[model samples]
Target: MSFLHSLGLFATLGLIYGCSTTSSLTSAQQRDAYLQQFIGQTSQSIQARLDLNSIGYQQVLAPVANDQTLTYTVIRPVTIPVPIAQNPADIDAGNIPIPVTPRAQSYDVNLQCKIIFRLENNMAKSVYYTGRTC
Candidate 1:
């Protein structure tokens, strides 16, 4: 009986761990799909479509007159639950009560999208898009 219980517990833990890891991969895949549409497009076109001003820009590498690389980072806010105070006396003694509800917290996840454009004679000759979310 003890062996069976231990096996079940391990199985449950394994499933939980697997799920947590898979979610990040899924997020990365989704971001990759969205960035694919920018391939073969000029930097100006991509900026216009994505509204670079609203998201804010990160780095601009323009080593020469014709070649330019633009990096844009987008941040999404996420809310998560926090532990509530267990001691009733502490809550009463403090001015603020222990929040039972979830509080807004900022996660460290950020998506960085880079657009590299090579121009020849003031015309875009090649364009590349790469992004990662973590």
Candidate 2:
């Protein structure tokens, strides 16, 4: 392979590796990666950049002495699969369907994720998250 061809191949491989690694990250990992950008940003800046109303996140502020804690709470819908009672008439006779087999019914429930930013002098010192969705 020529020099240019070899360089192009390496670049393609690097992109593939980078994409695979990013795709394998869990939901919490992805959230943390996205929230990490706000570290050291001022509260005003964070407020301006993060559209709480548009994104469905509820913003709350808690004052602790001189320091403050800013929390963003969002409810995420989680679909839970539960085994439902199977009707005998619904089973096909030709297929010999087992009556003991359970059919799953999905139900959506609201799960909340709380993003907390610790602020000192109105500047975000650190950030973390808690709750089921996180």
Candidate 3:
């Protein structure tokens, strides 16, 4: 009985640990506050503040002719696999061996961070970001 009780305690502790380790995305408010620091800063300065390898920038034509905006976008992809269940009834009826095979389906979860920097006189006049982060 002591062994069984110890097993149950371990199982409960395992569940608690597993639940605490689950990953989640950063809150929108937090992301907005972090991106707000880029306003009035040059692209070079912004690059200095973040990991350059993870950052991508593009030049886009603004709504007004001859105006341009620099946009920076970061993307992280998480791969998750579809779960499969075995048909116990079919296996028992056919006395078949369990098949060894790879999973048939999986999906890529894309977490994106996009920041638009409006430029005036080669300096960032305004900054805004949109998208999710995990």
Candidate 4:
């Protein structure tokens, strides 16, 4: 009975330990490695090019990202809802009603992976994403 209890406790502790390390890049070396891997990624798993007017990642996490290692991620594709003309374009010419504004549909840009970064201090330091503009 005593031996079984000890084994169970050990297993529980081991599971907890494993979970803690999942996102805990605990050292600068680890952060650097992670940033390198992060930047090397060719694409994002959820990339939707912002409208030239639309805001990029910076506006979202300003001051904090400037000082410490920052990481942002999305699990799936970032979909932009393009209001497509759901109405049929090929309606008969003679009886066609006046065309209203075209409705848009959603299309997604699939990014191959997630984006992460490591910053040194309060500035948009270039830890990654040099080849491509964020």
Best by TM-score: 2
Candidate 3: tens digits of C-alpha lDDT, residues 1-134: 57567656655665455434423334344555565677787666765674423332232322221245666665555444433445578788997856645544333445566666677765667766566342
| Distance from true location, Cα of 132 in model 1, Å | 8.0
Indicate the TM-score of model 2: 0.55
Give per-residue CA lDDT, model 1, range 64-129, as digits (tens): 233455445343333222222255676678856544433322112333456554555444555455
- List where candidate 1 sits over 4 angstroms from the true fold: 1-23, 51-66, 85-101, 104-133
C-alpha TM-scores of all predictions: 0.42, 0.55, 0.48, 0.24
What lDDT tens digits, residue by residue, belong to model 2 across residues 1-134?
Answer: 77567656655665555445433447546566667788899877886686544443344443222358777766654444433333456565444555442323333456567777899988898887787454
By lDDT, the better pick of 3 and 4 is 3
Give the Å shift of residue 75 in candidate 2: 1.3
Off by over 4 Å in 4: 1-58, 63-68, 71-93, 103-116, 120-134
Better of 1 and 3 by TM-score: 3
- Report the error of model 3 at residue 13, Å: 29
Error of 3 at 4 (Å): 42
Candidate RMSDs in Å, in order, are: 9.5, 15.4, 10.6, 19.8
